[model samples]
Target: MYLRLMYLSSLINIILSFNITDYLYRYEYFDQSETTTTKLESALIKFQEFYNLQVDGTLNNDTIELMSRPRCGVSENPSEFYTYGNKWTKNQLFWYFAMADATMLKIANRVFDIWQNYTNLNFIYSIKNPDIIISFSDNIFVHKNNPRCMKGECLFPFDGKSGVLAHAFAPRQNKCIEIHLDKGEDWYIGFNKTPLAQTSLFKVLLHEVGHTLGIKHSSDPTSIMYAFYSENTDHLSKDDIEAIQYLYGKRKESSTTNTSTTTPASTTPATNTTNETNKTKEIKLDLCDIWTNKF
Candidate 1:
């Protein structure tokens, strides 16, 4: 069944000037396929459900435009099994560095701290085997059994050549929770200081870590878990906080909290794109086909 789908997709790609593979790699939202059958149709339906799109399987202008948008690594496939069960069983989680430099480690710690500040969930750094493993790899095919990854790739390579940023696995189910970053990208500590720069390290990790905690992407563009990266995004939106809290109840209030980060009011902003078709092309983060790339 998979081989048949691939052959048909290959033929369709040859006929079309636009590369659907590249689109899927960047977004990592829906399964990328050329054949317009039920497989593609079902994937599209899942995409619409994940993003609150109208559920027509046929590709429309809106679906295509949304695909062009930036997003996180969590695949929209509803069938994938994830083990984020019963509110984590405990509030504490230990993490390890599979491979990281000083800079990546620093930013990773900061990301963990940021998440901790909001919820009762706590992240502790460990040298031993950890529940969550973080690493940077130029090798796209590294992890195949990672169930958290969605399937697809662009004809143009992902590394420094194209848009895939990074991806992560859902927690509890895998032997070790994992986050794989594309080594091809030039990463910066904070926001992109210049237009010619690479992806933001802090922002990208925040999105991926959310996946490790069982939180999925939200339809809200301002959400940290939104499938794409938005320039204005700096802090977690109310939706992000609410979703995480929903999984594991709200954080207990503390005195003398950190003042550097300001929490947004619980109300969500009204300016995000509605169900209507979006005409603008979105610059999105890209990822690899974890299984296919390995083979």
Candidate 2:
């Protein structure tokens, strides 16, 4: 009897958790039951289904373990993975745009600064064919059935009314990244308290930039990369930082390299061949269809 009571309490805690409870509500689990075995089982089943886990409706070890894993807003399409491998090859990447208002541009620069502070990669402001472009628009879809952007294209569109707050494309060679902000949505400049309906510009841009840097969403609720946006005070969680590091690697110490005064030796043919091979190994990604596969 004591063991059973303890189990019920544990179940209650899990059900009440923000992430789990939010998901349950989405599936129409309105009943607020603390100890009801049936309700708990049903909720667990729905949770498992959403995650593509084994739907036994029981809180098995696998379910619990999966709950702890990081998930991305982007779907794990196998073919897409093959095409847009991951990570940027160069350290200095440029972000170009004048589409947003002055206020938004200021905030965006701050976001860029934060990302650069944490990683070796940099987001330089440029006008001449930037690697990423920041733009704003509304009514992205012409018809409900057809989306303006296709698969593997780096153009991201945001219709404010659409459930999607914002979306971004992973890195691609041929196409430059285009991050779109929904013009209809109310965007807050700073951390001032705002209603649930209004979205924070800084937070959204930070997450989108993560996508551009080849980061998937994290399952950890505290992570900025999580599918849902929250009003958390922290800009980047440990998981979020780790995810970027996995792609670009940890920020290295800056030191100037001394140029060799003696450049008399010519490069061997074998050395040149190896250098060419390394450059050719660059991975290409098709971000055209990425917005359609959002989680």
Candidate 3:
């Protein structure tokens, strides 16, 4: 009996080690080539340091819990230095929805407004030749002709429901800026009424939009740019504000007047075009029913 219990304990440790290693590799803590024991510990330590967790180089309960939480698909920076040296040269940027409904459009407008409130940048809704394009999909196939999937045939395909809620591309010269949300997620619009299992479209959009503007993930958990999603956080933290301002100087005093309005842009209905049309309809029926009833 004693030997059996010891064997079970060893099995559990092995499983936990595998999970931690996969998590580190997935989030860019380290590369697959450097999969030695020391490298794994170092990567774990780096991840802990980023989240302000105790750096004991061990997979404690806290680390495992944090790892399981929903987070942006974008990988966290491996270094202390923030900002990827990528920023839009133009102040006026046009964005369009390749796949979204009226409700989603409204939420996006509010998100863009939040960013505009801080920087000199301006976001406009355009139907054609938009600088940023947003979409919802369960699986993103790589198109060799497409710059967005430059790395390979499949760039971080969505794994359904929880793990990665969304991901976006930073500004790049001659490359398209894109944001893709997992259609499988139970996405709610507002802060007050979000169900425990549902993700706030507002918060996710707020974070992805930051990425569209070339803002990288922040180590500060309070910041919207933080890799992991937090239900309690509704607005940008100081780190978020500073990061945006650093890329594009603060909003001018005269421009303090709120020019952008939360007007829903005419966008392609998600149910009308994508392969996930049926799924999108089901999501709207379930979530929007509650949304309409509340307001």
Worst 10 residues of 2 by lDDT: 270-279
Ordered list by TM-score, greatest first: 3, 1, 2
**What is candidate 2's lDDT per residue for 82-189, written digit by digit as tens?**
123667788777775433333455556667767777777766665445677655545552211112223332333443332346666788764466665565566665
Q: Kindly provide the TM-score of model 3 when superposed on the true structure, using C-alpha atoms.
A: 0.79
Residue-wise C-alpha lDDT for candidate 1, range 11-61, written one tens digit per residue: 554346446544443345454554455556666676777667778975776
Model 2 local distance difference test score? 0.54
Reference-based lDDT, each prediction: 0.57, 0.54, 0.73
Candidate 1 worst ten-residue window by lDDT: 264-273
Residue 80 local lDDT, model 1: 43
Instruction: Report RMSD for candidate 1.
Output: 13.6
Query: Better model by TM-score, 1 or 3?
Result: 3
Report the Cα lDDT for residue 207, model 1: 86
